[model samples]
Target: MTDFTHMELELEAILHASNDNIIVTDDKGIVLRAIKNSEEFYGEPSEKMIGKSVYELEKMNVFSPSVTRKVLEEKGEVRLLQKTASGKTVMAKGIPVFNSDQQIVRVISLSHDLTEIQQLKEEYEKLQSKVERYESEIEKLKKRETPLDELKTKSPIMRKAQETLKRVANSEATVILFGESGVGKTLFARAIHRESDRHLQPFIDVNCGAIPASLAESELFGYEAGSFTGASQKGRMGLIESADGGTLFLDEIGELSLDIQVKLLKVLQEKEITKIGAVSSRKVNFRLIAATNQDLKKKVQEGTFREDLYYRLHVIPVEIPPLRERKEDLPMLSERFLHQFNSKYGKQTTLHPETLAKCLAYSWPGNVRELENVMERLVIMSDQPVISPQLLLLDSSQTDEPQPWMGIESFDHQGKTLKEVVLEIEQNWLLRAVKEGRSTYEMAKKLGTSQPTVVRRLKQLQSDSK
Candidate 1:
């Protein structure tokens, strides 16, 4: 080829090199040449495609009216959407290739794949759904505002906890949820049940403390029609029976009397329950999840909770740290609650950064429940969009102004000794790590230590803090 012809050829190659799939075909629709991606998208050998009718490909669906045929008949160009063999959607533009005499020589089709467009569409739909949910939640908030809905937490600790829940959700082992009251233990338990294999089945929640001593046993195990004087005409199935093949969440298990604890232990061991005033024993299959604000170990030692039951429930122990422990989550929780309250009140609202900082600084005695209540009150009462710290009622009496946890020390005065301060900081970090649900492996990797050493230190920190 001459220099000018070589330059023309190089330019043609660069133009064709554009990522779009290029298929050159004759007037009869025979594929004369195809780009590399054409083979990938169509799952066909490009070399073999030569001399073969392009419309014969499964994706092209031979009889279908397409841009290729349109360009050939009109002796012009046409654009249309097309599908590839890999189920990929594409936008194809077909232009008639003409000779110097103006005779149609072939057709050059440019295929622009719609992979990114489809992904963007999906993302848009997701964001739209989220916006709708936010609007709906706002409307609900305006009606009868509940503090629970206002709960927002984005702390790494909370994230790790959610991650762990997702991991063991399919397991059948008994789960003991340890946390202070108002820490949303029941919420976590319900979330787990919803994500578990028994999602379709009933999730019966039993507040052991709420159930009367007289009716507790019958309510849990159920009674026959004539088992008790007040029994219904039809035999009543107990909570245990109702939760068959599902999950039975026992809240405040520490409150269950020793006698009842014995019966619960038997059910856990034997996988069966005998109803009050009933002769026959019925087999039951249900996962057990127990939660408590009280110290279960102390209860066991006090001759209240049975040791066997404690061990059984403690198999998959999940200790939820108090709100004060996971201080980092406070801002997220506050913001979430603000959004929830904003929707309900039909008012645009936001939290002042300073006000939120005070909330995080304050030692939450009542845990998450307390924070939720405070946020709810702020939402309902505050006329301004931004909630201020003054609304929280954190006076000097309520909290230490200068030093929240400890009294302010003089510059010359010795407050906490060097050892005490170091120990306190260490305890706080260790507690924070544990509260964040850092596994032994994860903690070791982060702390630059072996797993065993991390585990040993964590146990020691917990003990020392206690």
Candidate 2:
């Protein structure tokens, strides 16, 4: 082919590749060729319309107000919106191609359908509306908030556990709380549920160990009416179904039987459950938080716990530090519980410094729960305003865990001579004896000295200040 013909083909190829829908027709409005996209724009492929007339296409209601006819009549370019048979709209442009005679030989047409862009705009508006609605709901949820101050911790290990809870509170991820018993795993689970979007819904907390092994399956998965002996007349919803649109906390989940573990795994995988005698399953949805004081991985290895179920519950493992590891929080926790009990029982009880010292010295075998019971006992049983040190050791002898006892320092030796330190210790000992209402004879007997010597030494120490 000649260079002019080659350049012409190249130009046509560039026009066809352009984003615009280009159609070429003779001056008589007979369709000769059209770009590929024009078929989607008009609902008819270019090959089928190669020899068709634009007049017949208009009569067939393909598109109204033909731009090709306007270009022929006015002998110039025409651009306007055309209505399609699908009730959608398009922008069409037509230009007359003339030869050396200045008379029109062909009409070049380009059009674009606005339906897709319009649909996208509409969808964008709908998405914006949904976002606004959710933001408003979150704001309302923030107003009716749970007592998160209970979760405020002092130790670094406990802080890390709180962070994990906050991050997963708004999601559907399963969380497993690992810690010793009485470390507040149940409290953490409830906090997560209250802080979540499903706060308004029920929070079903089930303790696998608390329920008997004989009734465990029926209690968790429910039973149909008359399904077994002594069954309820009407079927009851189990803990799993009762937590729909909320949260499910399975405390001591490690204690569940292997048979129940397999069924629980199926419920998690399918998000549905069938009653004991029911053929069809009913759907349920809830966030799951599992807690265990036992070694679950060991159970998995021993075939007591299902491996699949362990992995499902182990999605986000948060280990809460036992109270022994975070002993620094003991003082604050003790004060809070003291005030709590004082207000609860309408008593004006205060913790004695000696009592607090003994509490700090002993390792918390039962963790926060033990402290709570201890404080409540002090408040209710104490007759005086200040609790006595004698009562603090009520049940320390029978505790399950060993007590790595710590003793309070008598005095600090910084910037002090040995004689001064000894004198200070003697004064402190005498003052403690006075606070305990011990006479000189009792003090002398304990220190292996005479009563007159104790009286004379106490008088000398008192006179040294003057």
Candidate 3:
């Protein structure tokens, strides 16, 4: 053979040996050539495909949306996904050949099967979804475990409280947390919610006293669009409705008005709420955790709080002892706060012995929150690594004095009888003891009396004042 014939035979051999399916068509969309692999990918022999019109093959279901036809119509290169009669998916690209006048002369089509790659991509997506689901479940488990872990305490009373909380954590019973202001009632409420089965849901907290009386009803029960003057055009969902399938925490619940109390009672009883200016009531499902520093029983007797509502909320009551009652936990609580603030402010500071002594001695009327704030202030403002007692902003004159008659001396008792004078003195002493101490036990210790004596005297004092 001649050199030109040898080169043509070599080129044909290379084209036929290619793994990719190759097809060549004339400008009129008739197949001029096809590779041997066409039989494998298109379920047709190369000799049969040759000399056939692409439109006829497409009509015969050999392959879909002929790539040669696309290149001919667009007069340019085209790329697309194609499915063959053999059910093989492919990535097909069509290239157009132009003559000297820039007119279409021939079309070359190349295709790569993507069936295996597509299957792998689908498998990867499924694995990714499973991993995401596992991560979400792990996060929920951590949340459920951390609430009780976060309650760091060494006091017997606090340990008992935690045990009680653990016992009722899984129950759907309404919880009432009673304590002095700043005694971590809100924290305990949140802990109870987190440890419950509803931890994955939202935790909605509303300070009943913080909301205005004018807006309390609408804020708790929601309102329809244009229900009242200045109402939002889109309407608003109430705090109770928004907490559905979650925990609704009402802090300072005693501050709600009597009218709102009645409505809240209905929600607790019926598990439903009605929006303002709406005819229908929507059912709501949620765990209720209410907190208050005031005496709800006293409020009930005085007609300020509803009696039936108080009982409903008083289910599984959790009384958080004040800081003074649990003074043994001070060191641990203080150290925890110090570590927290150190990490926050990037400081390595230690409290002085005298500082801790002063902290333990002073009556923390504001409870744990007060100590936390003081520690944060010391961490931020102190110039040295060792915090001293002087760094604590507690007033010595207010806390160090032992006289119960400090403020009483300023009152006018000159014209009072001796009997009245002695009665005033007794009342002043009782009040001072109660104010300085945490509970009746602590008050009795300070007054050199029994806990029952302190309780009885305080009860009498409360009655006399009323």
Candidates sorted on TM-score, descending: 3, 2, 1
Per-residue lDDT of candidate 2, residues 321-402 (tens digit)? 8887765466677777877788878888766654654565456778889988989988888999988878876455532243
Residue-level lDDT for 414 in candidate 3 = 66
Q: After superposing candidate 2 on the true structure, give the runs of residues whose Cα lies further than 4 Å from its correct spot.
A: 1-149, 394-466
Better of 2 and 3 by lDDT: 3
Ten-residue stretch with the least lDDT total in model 1: 404-413
Error of 2 at 210 (Å): 1.1
Best by TM-score: 3
Q: Per-residue lDDT tens digits of candidate 1, residues 1-466? A: 7999999788559646888877788879888777755566566667766778755653455223456777877888898877666667778899997899998888988878786797798789867965664465345434433222233443446665666676787889788888998888987787777667886566778899899998889889898877778788666768888778878999999988889889989998999999888777989999988999999899889887789888988888887888876765665566666677778778776665445545645667787788888888898888987666578785433331232222224112246587765654554454344333325565466556776876566445323322
User: Per model, how many backbone clashes are there?
Assistant: 5, 0, 0
Better of 1 and 3 by TM-score: 3
lDDT for 253 (candidate 2)? 98
Q: Count residue pairs with overlapping backbones in model 1.
A: 5
Poorly placed runs, candidate 3 (over 4 Å): 1-146, 397-466
When 1 and 2 are scored with TM-score, the better candidate is 2
Q: Please, what are the lDDT tens digits per residue for candidate 3 over residues 1-466?
A: 9999999888678778887789999999999888887988898899999999999999988889789989999999999988899888888999999999999999999988987897798789867865675466456546433486578775668988999998998899988889999999877877887789998776778999999999999999999999999999868789898788888999999999999999999998899999999899989999999999999999999999999999999899888999877665676778878988999999998776446656755768899899999999999988999887688879655353344444447555667797876766676676566556645677788779988887676545433432
